[model samples]
Target chain A: MTINKELMKGSTVILILTLLDRKPMYGYEMSKEMEKSSSGVLTLKEGTLYPILHTLESDGMVESYWSSGEGERKRKYYQITKKGQGLLKEKQREWISFRTAVDQVLGGGPA
Target chain B: MTINKELMKGSTVILILTLLDRKPMYGYEMSKEMEKSSSGVLTLKEGTLYPILHTLESDGMVESYWSSGEGERKRKYYQITKKGQGLLKEKQREWISFRTAVDQVLGGGPA
Candidate 1:
């Protein structure tokens, strides 16, 4: 099912950090990997991806470096920093708590 | 744990609708019940609560009416409309899909 954009907004940073936590990847590669792994459920638009990346970089959560690919294409690759990893862990914990909280409300009805 | 406000933004509507789905409640009652049922994990601030209710009412998802509670205090109670229930079901499904998607991305790593 297509997710609401507003709902999707909260997840973008964590998603990016999770991907980078695995290995460094350029923007297009990360986007494709997310879509493929999620079975097209989470499509990160390029426009949205770049700004978040920039923000994360500014916040020192991630760092970007330029590298030349096989086709001599220069791409900016993002790698998770120590700070990013820490934030990723925190975000993961928060996500679990948030999910559980939401489930509690959704299932409990009125109390 | 206190959820990040950004993450919390996406869930307010679903949470509010879920409560009303069980029974109608005034603003304060709903807020208190949400905190109680979630064991204080989900706290709905009154400021954030009213605007969403107003939006839901305007969108025909919920309707509100004033009622006299104890001490003869008039309060506006909100109840879910048919449209709200429909939206709630859809939001629930989307939430599941989203949770699944995030899990896929988080666990699969570089796919």
Candidate 2:
């Protein structure tokens, strides 16, 4: 399904953090995993993913390190920090609450 | 619960459209109804509400008319257009799909 960009704006951060919480992943790997996990419903474009990763790193929500991969190619991998885990919990709660609020207004889900 | 403003951004339009879909309403009435329907979770602040209503009016999704209420006060009431109804259906579908996608990534809810 074609998702609205506006709707995807705030969600991108949550998706990235959820993936990182599972395991440390390089940028490309995270994007691929997100696509796979969502069954291709959510694809983090290279243009969008890098900036979010950079911001998350700067905010101390995640930390990154350079590591050599299968081809001896250095890749930057991001791991969720303690702070990121805390924030992720909060965002997840907020997501559920927000979804409930929207569903209430739309009148189509559990009340 | 305090929602992230970023998450609220894309949803405000949908909420407004949903309310207007039910019936014509002045700005204040719509805000109040939204708060009530969402069980006080979604409050549309005056600062944020008017601009959206005005934009929706200009976009032809909704049309506005001045109506005199009690105490001889004139309020600008908005009613959804045919085009607006069409958009509302599309947005509602998108919302459900987007929520499902988020749920899938979060590892919660029905698949």
lDDT, candidate 1, A16-99, per-residue tens: 999999899999998898888788888999999999999999999998999966788898999999999999999999888888
Top of the candidates by lDDT: 1
Poorest stretch of ten by lDDT in candidate 2 chain B: B102-111
Total backbone collisions, model 1 = 0
Candidate 1 - CAPRI tier?
A: medium
lDDT of 2 at A66: 94
Best by the TM-score measure: 1
Off by over 4 Å in 1: A69-71, B69-71
lDDT of each residue in A1-111, candidate 2, tens digit only: 667778887788999999998888899988888888887777889999999999999999999999966778888989999999999999999899999999989983222
Give the TM-score of chain A in candidate 1: 0.92
Candidate achieving the largest DockQ: 1
Predicted candidate 1 versus true structure: per-residue lDDT over B56-95, tens digit per residue? 9999999999996678789899999999999999999988
With candidate 2 superimposed using the best TM-score fit, by how many Å does residue A105's alpha carbon deviate from the native? 0.3
**Pairs that clash in candidate 1:** none
